[model samples]
Target: MMKYILGIAALLFFSCGNKEDILLPKADRTIVKEVMDLSPIYIFFRVNGKDTLAEVNRKNSISTTNWILNIDKRLPLRLVIPEVMKLQEKRRGDSAHKNEAAQNYYSYADSIGKNLAFIPFTNVHYKMVKPKAEVIVFFDKSNKIWVNGLMIKNDKFKNFINEFIDKKSENYQFCFSEDLSFGNYIQYEIYLQSLKINNGQEFIN
Candidate 1:
């Protein structure tokens, strides 16, 4: 099933004239934990805006060769998931030899019968593509949205996103209050899906 998904992604990669980069979809929680256990270095993501990945890596002497992700479980899935994707992007190599470090990252993913490549779920199969323009979306506890730091009514979300889409805006940064409930978060996720918004980074206050 994993291969099938990746194969489809590869086809999409080519079909789109290689315009977009293919990313490994999110892995199961258990699998992620197992990979972390086997890894020598751990890269942790915190909600506080203190530590950047580069800082942590440099401080720990973490080489790109071996490291696993560690995100706080208390963080909402909506907020943290996109950061994980971004982390994968940060760790990726140049388009020519991107998967060079795959072996160190995904050996454990392979042993679990995933039949994935050296860096399973590590975006090893896809080429790298940089994001276009960035659109900032912030939501308060009341679910009110602010676009590019300007406040807008909730009903205007679709219109705002559609306008951006027309302008070829492919990247979004989603920021929301930490007090939001999982149910509220899912609603926004579904709404975004309905709007055909697929590529974005997320943050929680």
Candidate 2:
């Protein structure tokens, strides 16, 4: 009877121990599982304002490479450890390249001649002259000029008219002419881009 009681007690102890072991949650299982299901190259989390190594560390409490492994269990341990340093170098190189490109995108105009005339009127004699005397532009609150069914170059022409045109009806007809020395005939067309606010958010004339 004593032997049977001892055997039963040992069996119960072993079974309970096995159950506890089975129930024990794996360390960082949530984080590990989340990482394991993701591919290494596309696995990304925003670290800072744009996405850099430091931001990853600050947010994830680990290096960027380690974070990669947490998502990709197939990653070699050696590769995971050096990811942060490598990413930092890559980020620095990318920034330098962008800066270089921006530096090269500058143009200086030595002489910008005023070679265009802008005229405002309700109705003017629509005549094409030999030298194209003047390009007459018409405008109300929402008017756009077009040539051959294509819009013109100036997006802020409405603002220019509004600024110069007098509110009084008597001064509604305004003529803007460039000196003949600028050019005999310039080829250009105007189109209404949008009926929206200018920089001041005021309705353009």
For this target, which candidate reaches the highest TM-score against the unseen true structure? Answer: 1
lDDT for residue 74 in candidate 1, whole number 0-100: 30
lDDT by residue (55-78, candidate 1, tens digit) is 122233233345543222233444
lDDT (tens digit, per residue) of candidate 2 on 1-205:
0010111101111222331100111111111112222112211222356533211222322222222211111222122224433443443356434332111000011112211112111112221121221222432212334322334445655565467534433333222122111111111111221322111111111
Clashes of each: 0, 5
Alpha-carbon RMSD, each predicted model? 14.1, 30.4
lDDT, each prediction: 0.43, 0.23
Clashing pairs in 2: 35-71, 36-71, 47-55, 145-190, 152-191
lDDT of 1: 0.43
TM-scores for all candidates?
0.36, 0.15
